[model samples]
Target: MHVLTMLLPVFLAFALMLCKLFNSLRTMEVQMGMGVVLLRYESPSLFWFVIAFQCLVIGALLAIIYCAFFILSNQVMS
Candidate 1:
């Protein structure tokens, strides 16, 4: 019971961090779009789309890695 109380908060914090990371990356993509439109003077939307899509893919990979890290670490600790 005591172990769970301590670990629960840790797990929640880790989860929140992952969520925030992804959200910030998404916001970055939006900002990049605005920058391209206002500064580049090019119809490079497809390029931005690909870049943002890569970010999305990378985000998923990071999430998977983060979860796996936590799980393995918790297993080792126990």
Candidate 2:
């Protein structure tokens, strides 16, 4: 329940995709017409506000990973 609340606004699409994929793998009864997928969530403001910060954090992490991989690859070649 808490996870649903937290992910409702920001990761709603991802969560729904996961749900659909999981449902297809088995008969979880979560299958419904695509039109019925409503995302009427509370605290939308919280998700909107956090989106930018989350993007920055993810970007920073990716940058670090890229740098680390580049350095390691250079070392391997030398």
Candidate 3:
């Protein structure tokens, strides 16, 4: 029980971080138009996209690793 109590908070924290990361990256648009005028800007090309994608992948991988370790520790403690 004590093991779970400690590990749960860490899991929640990771879940929140992943949620925020995804929310922030969810809105990557190049153009927004209302009909009166068209506004567009190049935030980043394929290069930037690739970079961001890599970061996301790495972040998720690290989170998974952390989760795995947390579970292992919890099991070992019991």
Candidate 4:
């Protein structure tokens, strides 16, 4: 019971972060679709910027997931 109380907020926060990350990815997908439509008219630099931003987001997402799993594993082992 005590462990449950301590871990509940962590679980909630993890879920919330995952939800926000997914929402951002969805938004980025929509933007990318629009970007494709405008690619011919847009500057090359703008397209590269979008690609860089996406890579950064994906890297961060991977790192967050790794950390979450590490923490959960540690919790379970202990």
User: Largest lDDT belongs to which candidate?
Assistant: 4
lDDT (Cα, tens digit) per residue for candidate 2, span 5-77: 6434545554555555454335423223675432214444543344444456555655555655566447754
Candidate 3: list runs displaced more than 4 Å.
Answer: 29-78
The residue-by-residue lDDT of candidate 4 on 1-78, one tens digit each, is: 454575566666666556544654455431444454324235566655655665666566556657666666577554
Q: Name the better of 1 and 2 by lDDT.
A: 1
- Please list the C-alpha lDDT of all candidates, in the order they appear: 0.53, 0.46, 0.54, 0.55
The number of the candidate with the highest TM-score is: 4
lDDT of 4: 0.55
Q: Write the per-residue lDDT of candidate 1 for residues 1-78, one digit (tens) a residue.
A: 454564565566557655644554555432344454222224356546655665676566556567656765587553
Q: CA lDDT of 5 in candidate 3? A: 70
C-alpha lDDT of candidate 3 relative to the true structure: 0.54
RMSD of each: 7.5, 13.9, 7.8, 7.4
Worst 10 residues of 1 by lDDT: 34-43
Worst lDDT 10-window in candidate 2: 23-32
Q: Kindly indicate the candidate among 1 and 4 with the higher lDDT.
A: 4
Q: Write the per-residue lDDT of candidate 3 for residues 54-73, one digit (tens) a residue.
A: 46765776666676676666
In candidate 2, position 73 carries an lDDT of 47
